[model samples]
Target chain A: GAGVSQTPSNKVTEKGKYVELRCDPISGHTALYWYRQSLGQGPEFLIYFQGTGAADDSGLPNDRFFAVRPEGSVSTLKIQRTERGDSAVYLCASSPLPGTDTQYFGPGTRLTVL
Target chain B: QQQVKQSPQSLIVQKGGIPIINCAYENTAFDYFPWYQQFPGKGPALLIAIRPDVSEKKEGRFTISFNKSAKQFSLHIMDSQPGDSATYFCAASNYGQNFVFGPGTRLSVLP
Candidate 1:
């Protein structure tokens, strides 16, 4: 009955630092996704996981950005050498089957790179 | 480039009035069109959705009108309430792929 949840509702870090944002998808969800939302813009796709393996990582901006969902349940988005441009709300969503199914989103983690 | 485009970045409507938000996409491969509502400090929640085959779909006061030929879709909220004030985002996706979302529309339903 629980919805998706993310950790560290707000995180502030210095430039060049690394930060990890975690996501806990709803129970029984098989697909997970990560996105970034900048001010006055729509959420941009980051990465996707079908199970324990990432099905799509093309949305990831660069090699500094990486994500993992080892158990196919919980996921973590890791950012290396954070830049001010990376400052935005990191969103996580999950679906029951994937594809056309409705995606449930979490509150998101606002990461600020100062 | 933005694959999906939404019109009227902001809108204000009185209670019980209809507020329509329109969206258009350039990709013909897209099949799923859904609208999401979000409030401050909250993640987006699914409001209504429609497929390309269907011309329209309605759920409660929310309706989605899809035009397969024009590659356009619109969301109409009938008899809107003050509580309806929030940001609305229109998104499109192909089968089992990540969504391409529009910039979003901010709706203000006055009481």
Candidate 2:
């Protein structure tokens, strides 16, 4: 009965360092998504995975941003050579199907590049 | 260009009053309209959602009014309670695409 969960609730790292945010989707959830939320604005989609393969990754800002949902249960959003501008709340969500299904979100991991 | 535009970045309402948040989208491809509520330190939760096929949909004190021709939709909270005070976000997306969220409205209900 556990909902979606994310680890490393808050992470502060130096610029150019690498960081990985983890997400654990609900049981039997086949679709996972990643989003980034900037202050005073809305969440911007980063990537989404259907099972093991990423179905939609066009939202990823650049090549440095990547994600993997191997085993179709847990996902990790990895950022390489983090920039100060990459500081934001990274959110993860899951749904039963690909589209039209209500997504369940996790508490999110706040990544700060200090 | 922003796909979804929401108005009144913030709102204050009385406990028994109705707080309406409106949103407009430029992409006609959007078919599913969903509203999410978020607390200060938590993730967003699905509040209510609507499709373009229906003019209006109501669930309890929450109502969603859709205008297909106008490419707009609004969420109306009737007799809002203080517990409802939080950030409300309106999102638009197709059946199998990424959602575009609005800037969000910070609702403060005074009891």
Candidate 3:
């Protein structure tokens, strides 16, 4: 009965550098989602995966942001040419299935672009 | 334009008192509403959720009151404790779609 987990609790990188954030959803979960939370603001949707395939990715900010969940269990969020504006807490969540209302969330990774 | 709007950027209440937070959404397509609680340096946790079909739902001291006609909903925490101090976010989304979160309200419960 493990909850969702994320890697690199905190990350600091220089502008223009690349970064990758990983997420491990709860066992048996079929749906995954990614979000970004800036200081003093609510989380902003980034991408979502229904299985091995991404079901909804319209929330991705730009072409530089991408995610992959090849196995349908674990996911990784990749960012290219990181900018200061991208600094925020990257959150991952999972639900038992797509369309489920309640989602379990991970601690999240704080990315800082200096 | 923000799809979901929450009132009172912050609130302070004494222990055992009730604190109410309200949210309104512009999109009629939304059918699910959920409330999440988060502490500093941590991700949000689901506190409670409600569907448009029901007018109100209660779990323990947490209650969600929904108004389908006005497109508004509110969360009322009865007998709040100091440990309840944190940020609360109200979110709305259609089934199987991405969620839209409000700016959030910071609640402070004094012992």
Give lDDT per model, in order. Answer: 0.92, 0.91, 0.94
- Write the residue-wise lDDT of candidate 2 on B54-97 in tens digits: 99999999999999998989999999999999999999877746
lDDT of 1: 0.92
> Where does model 1 exceed 4 Å of error?
none
lDDT of 3 at A112: 96
| lDDT for each residue of candidate 1 in A1-114, tens digit (9 for 90 to 100) | 999999999999999999999999999999898999998888898888998999889899999999999889999999999999999999999999856458999999999999
Worst 10 residues of 1 chain B by lDDT: B92-101
Clashing pairs in 2: none
Instruction: Return the candidate ranking by DockQ, descending.
Output: 3, 1, 2
Q: Give me the displacement of residue B90 in model 1, in angstroms.
A: 0.1
Better of 1 and 3 by DockQ: 3
Instruction: Report the error of model 2 at residue A49, Å.
Output: 0.8
Greater lDDT among 1 and 2 belongs to: 1
What does DockQ give for each predicted structure?
0.76, 0.73, 0.82
Interface RMSD of each: 1.3, 1.4, 1.0
